[model samples]
Target: MATDGHGGLIQPRKVPNPVRESQSHRELHRELLFSHSRGILPRHRAELPRVLESRRLRQLREELQGPPSDLEQQLRKCHQRLEEAAAGPDPGPRPEFLLVRDSLRKMKLAEPGAWQT
Candidate 1:
């Protein structure tokens, strides 16, 4: 039995059985003791924040690159195709017409959500 901070009755702290101590148990106990004295666990003292920051930075970098260049190229090709079609004798819908439409749809889908509204 133990006295609480306000003089109330409280359960006694349990003592670990020294007889059951093994290598792993000793290591665990050491880690627990160290963590209790310090603010953070030793193994993870700097790892968590660094990993999270790196992940955030990677996402930001990818966002900075904007849309992929291939999408822009496809759009340019579509424009060129339109110009050529307008200049030449009207040839009704080529098979490549479907490809241009698909590329435009893909480009729309690949745009960032913020731009989509």
Candidate 2:
């Protein structure tokens, strides 16, 4: 028995059985993907924000022989998408659409004359 934070005799935490843990993780991944495909998982609820951030960061790190353009706008759009996702309920199914939109926005920003008013 493990003592609780309050000094109570809390039940011993069961160590995760390796096989069970693996199976459970796989199940969870599958469920996440399913929910995303079904549009049940909102963009903010899913991993889109993290993925977009990572991509944007990577792009920023790449050497640009030309001018420093579109990066700020792209980042801003990513931030907006994240905010929108956070503001809305889980968009079950079609989470990919959010990702696609983010990608397109980034690409557009990358293109010359694409970031016009």
- Tell me, by TM-score, which candidate is best: 1
Please report, in order, the local distance difference test score of every candidate based on alpha carbons.
0.81, 0.79
Candidate 1: tens digits of C-alpha lDDT, residues 3-54: 5675885668989887557788888888898887886755576887878888
TM-scores, in order shown? 0.22, 0.21
Instruction: Name model 2 segments beyond 4 Å from true.
Output: 1-68, 93-117
How would you encode candidate 2's per-residue C-alpha lDDT over 16-111 as one tens digit per residue? 778756978889888999988887764556587778878988787765544446997798899999999999997677689889999998899789
**Candidate 1 clash pair list:** none
Per-prediction CA RMSD (Å): 19.3, 24.4
Give the TM-score (vs. native) of candidate 1. 0.22
